[model samples]
Target: MPLSIYNTLNRRLEPLRPRDPKRVTFYTCGPTVYDDAHIGNFRSFLAADVLRRFIESPLCELEGSGPGPRSVVHVMNITDVGHMTDDDQADGGGEDKMAVAGRRLLEQKKSGKLPPGVELDPNSPYDIARFYTMRFLDDAKKLGLKVAIEHDKDASLMPRATANVPGMIALIGKLIERGHAYVVGPAGARVVYFHVPSFEGYGALSGNTLDALREGAGGRVGTENQSGKKHPADFLLWKEDSTHIMKWDSPWGAGYPGWHIECSVMSAARLCGSGSVLSPAQLVQMQVPDAQPIIDIHSGGEDNIFPHHECEIAQSCCAFNASHSGPYAGMWFHPRFLFVEGAKMSKSKGNFFTARQLYLPAPEGKGIAPAAIRLELIRTHYRSNANFTEQGLKDSARMVERWRRFMDTAGKGSTSSDAAARGACREAIAAAMHDDLNIAGVLGELNGWLGRVDAPGPEDAELLREIDAVLGVLELEQAKSAQTDIGVFIGCEADPAVLAKLNERVEAKKAKDFARSDAIRNDLAAMGYQIKDVAGGKVEVRRG
Candidate 1:
């Protein structure tokens, strides 16, 4: 069956057919880099990674052969600047996100979190941007999200927002010249804003009517205030103010570009190759093609559907209409938020934690493995709110261990993979992934298939390995470290509690009560012990 994905634009699952049949260009809205990225942020990243993997897999035909752009070009934008303290503000009244990071670094240094003699340049936005960007990339690596910067044309490219300010200025100028945007405020404090009424498709993405939006806007004015704008809903395109630490010289004044404008400029310049830096007049006179979205897929957290991404669509569509012409993204994909411990992960609730924090050991709390963390992220559907539970983490760890052992045993020799098992597993996995990334369904089917394979044929082993390629977990080296060293044979004395559980499981197995046997094994696994069955009716319970 053809791959189908839920397009947020149309509010339905549409067949994922690229306009350019040879390659797919996808853009995912990345981190704001104001602080350490939490697990909630990584959920969106991991979901995009899964989508990329599936698109490149054999089940999909998006990939094309050539030295040209790979079958997929995934561009993830790092918002290192202009992301405000509040989104409703038209005059960039909120604190600059990079400066926020800078202040945070200064605080860390004062708190002695940084080693002695490493002084941070307080004036440099580069310090904060580079620092957190590296951390975010490191987190992505730990989660095994592929990066496109390492000489891979089809790999994902993470473009920094600050790096494309010139392009943003040019685009904002175009918005002004085309009447899609207007200047607000007076003199040096003038802020350029996108006129909401100019675009007929303004609220199509968020489904908010202009009248309702205007009504809501009365209570949502920014620090500069929207009194000068044509409408209250007109968002800032350029902030011509001196207060921003991360400021640049622009035609409007010496201020930074607004938060929403960066995405439009960067995507157009980087992905679409709109290389020239032209003023609004220059762009309007240039015979640019009819309006069209430069990307194939645009993704982000569900929270960005309004004002942020919605503004992106309006500005980009208007900008394209002026210069190029059309859609911002063929399909929009927004992954639902990831909740922590059954509550919204909030600092006030004391539940928010980063991906790196999960690598630490406890009463500070023992952390979950990165692979297990990734498994937990993908355990639920991308469109669903996933609760990060301790039980779920434990279950994921056990599943990881199970897959490791299965692959190691199945891949003992490179005789061919079991063709039948490989095809069955592949078909099931493809269908799950295609059905709007129904990863929960995929895991259930995979777990059942793996559990039934007692002595995996080469094909079964090969199939499991192939499955791991998309799932992006199952590291045998790490699993080996968790396996029991001396218990490869008959019943060995370990912890008495574990031994007793093993006895009970053995009884359950003999009595043909497989469900009870599996439950006991899962219980042992939750307690940090893996029950591995050895030869001659013996089992080995090892510390995981």
Candidate 2:
């Protein structure tokens, strides 16, 4: 009953082997901070969240029935700089995503679109980055990202790429001294490239050989960045660009680190570190040095498998332990892409959706609650593509409401469910989760169990609490104001005063104080609130 997962490195499903049972170090790529994260991007992050939740859960059955990882040292990086649009190359091609943000913000500023008191200097990419970074964090919180929730309390959990320039420069210098990287061009416009061919296991993760990359396989090995590279696949580590909007002083020149370098440096510094310095060279070392795994797992979208992650492997291997032949980390996980309405999401197609665009209630009375949005994004298996549609979102809302009612009902019960039945249900849910996060399977188990139970008991509530600890979609305390979008009517929390009165009425009914319940109803009517009891535990709160 050991937890198993598909490691993208060797293309094999294997057991999770964390060197330490107390603390499991995990890292996942965060938003680029140039724009709002689209639905597709969140699907990838949701996979990472689920993985962390399962890894830290006691339900994760491990080898010899030993105690599992007690805690997860999760680090998700905020790419406020150095990420490019065309990320397939080692030295990322195309425009800097932050620069694009700066330009857009400048235009908005000139048009007076930016709000007052929000003094945004479009010329300053740093200002633009912070703006979008905060917005992204807001969205991540609404979607229940644990790292995002604890980010304010622990800044180390989410490191910004711009803040780690020194670390990037240090790692690049190590690569150069180790002969894995070389500097080229003039002092005012110098460039550093990782000698991709120097690392023998360059294509072990992505299966893209140097031979194929040289021939422009998949058009990933771009001809634009061939000026100073030892090989076509030799990705850029540093580029001198004092003229750029966001430039940094580095060993190579006054420029910025490449997109691929940030993940390597941040992952090493944050996950396995010494406060301000990495004197012992943390996770830059081989996978397991003397039976110690500095970093456990790294994850991202499937699109990152290429030059982004591949180059990370080559550069980190060369910079940390030049002779070691292993992937950057011991394990790698990637989630599949997300589509909208059976097609790739595109603005022109009117199917694209940012997290906020769907989570916030719209003027047309169409919107998915935050928890429902989180549910929809993570309900499917990570390996499968989730096709988002309005119907699907509405279904998620109903599902959330259903779970809320179930939990509420369970809380009122004084007895326990059959012990064997409860154990079987928990086992089934855990088994589904251990199978590489079979979200669909786990949810199916939940629905089937809920349907069969006539009277939910105290044990059911405990079971739900355990399940929800991993799947954070159930906001048990939130009885959302019963929006008209979902087809069913249900009792929900309204204004504070109304909710308190309703609670009083429900309590009075439980105590058989019919007179008090009737008086509360009369009081609600006097307050211009129409209260009607519907069958099947649904109460309508129609405002007069």
Candidate 3:
């Protein structure tokens, strides 16, 4: 069966056929580095990760389908600048809470009310952005996301460096050259706005009329207004004058590139070439050689459709000249928002859970593991809003424990009847995942299959491994020592002689010597070490 995805542009579930069968270039707008990311932000990223995993999964093809001649190139850009706080704020009334808090803290320090040890750095925005970016990466790692950490790390370390400024300006120059954008002076400020009037079929992606677009744009009556724009729907390409913390030298003077332009410049520079766009044939050629370059799918929250993605489409298409596409992407996927206790998780309500805050302990001192929280987020349909609660997180943790127990049971022994049951389980799992990444459905199928297992067969074992590859929650082997201190238990406390004996026993288990393994376990138990058999035939030794 052909793969199908819901494209935001067409507003329908369409067949996913890349312009280049060999290589598919995909791009996702990454998190802005100004603040700590919340779980809701990571949910969008997880949806993209799952989509990428599906595209790249070996099981995606039918049996007899020899290695398909295709590759997926994924690119997610980190926005370090030009992201205004009011983008998501309705009526532009929302303030940058981080900045507000920083100012308040500064005032307290100035009044000599702060304790002697307390200190507030002058470069609070820079410090805050760096702190949150690092925390975001750590959280992403815990959730098993394979993001480009090296690039992100470099950006975080050198916060002042701007690598793509010249290329970005050139892109804007091309847009201006092609009459897709124009510079307008409004309210004594010269701002570059995309000429929405120039693009006749503007709202085709959103299926909104011009009047609707205007109304939506005009509705945003914030510190920044649309009066300067040629059309109310027009978005800024460059903010010419701003006293914001992060600014760059651009053709529009010492200002910052607009938020929407970052994706365009970054995507074009990384996927297509600088000053050149790839044709469909060239894209195919690039992919055939296993060049995981750009992405075939772009995903985010549903709220990013207008202005954000619309501007991205306009800028990218005009820059690349639609040379290598059936569509800009094979698909545009988006997940729904995550609410806290039936309400939107917002800072105003004090219900917001930043990645850092979530990693911290709850009121009772018990906290959810980052991985467990991630699983709970993914347990719901990406297209549906996930209601987050303490009970919900506990439920997800319990579910993970159940899966771990099943894997452990399967590894120990299996009966013929159990083997057959496991085979059925594998089939059910594949079917569930095939249905538009229906994770909730898959979990339900897992519960039913695991309940019937008296013993599992080879098929069940293989299926469990495959399922782990997709879900990433039941990482049985890795989770064994992930939460505890292995070094402290094994080599830290014990004498050299005792540690040597323990190492020999571990080696025996590695060599599959059951007698030696059992003897070692007995010896460890006699000692202060507690040896427990975990999933995948591995033993976790902890100091008793």
Best by TM-score: 2
Tens digit of per-residue lDDT, candidate 1, span 1-544: 6678899988999877676656677888888876778999989988988888777766653323322233666778888873443244434545555666677788877788864666567568877777777777777877777652331343226777777777788888777878888886788888888888888887778876586665675545443544677776777778776776778899889987877887876665556643233343443343335544557899899989987888898888887764423667888999999999999999899888888777433322244567888899987899989999888888998889788788777778556544676578778877887788888888878887777667765777767666776778864123212223323211123556766777788789999999999999899889876667767656655444
Instruction: Give the Cα lDDT of each candidate.
Output: 0.72, 0.77, 0.62
Regions of model 3 farther than 4 Å from truth: 20-22, 62-71, 82-125, 148-162, 186-188, 215-228, 273-295, 322-326, 348-350, 361-366, 414-421, 457-459, 476-544
Consecutive 10-residue window with the lowest summed lDDT within model 1: 476-485
Predicted candidate 2 versus true structure: per-residue lDDT over 1-544, tens digit per residue = 7788899987988788876657778889888888889989998998899888888887887554477547888889999884543233443445666777788888888988765777777777788888888889988888889999889888888998888888788788878877888998988989888888788888888888787666663565666647767787677788887887778887677987887988888887877663333532543342434323346798999999986888887776666553644556778999999999999999999898898776654332234578777888899888888888778887987888888888889889888767888889899999998887888999999888887777788888888878988888884223235643211223223567877787788889889999999999999889866687766554577553
lDDT value, residue 319 of candidate 2: 66
Q: Supply candidate 3's per-residue lDDT for 9.
A: 67
Query: Which residue runs does candidate 2 get wrong by more than 4 Å?
Result: 82-94, 107-117, 215-225, 274-294, 363-366, 476-544
Roughly what TM-score does model 1 have, to 2 decimal places?
A: 0.80
Query: 106, model 3: CA deviation in Å?
Result: 6.1
Supply the TM-score for candidate 3.
0.73
* Candidate 3 per-residue C-alpha lDDT over 444-468 given as tens digits, one digit per residue, 9 for 90 to 100: 8888876776676555656767777
Candidates sorted on TM-score, descending: 2, 1, 3
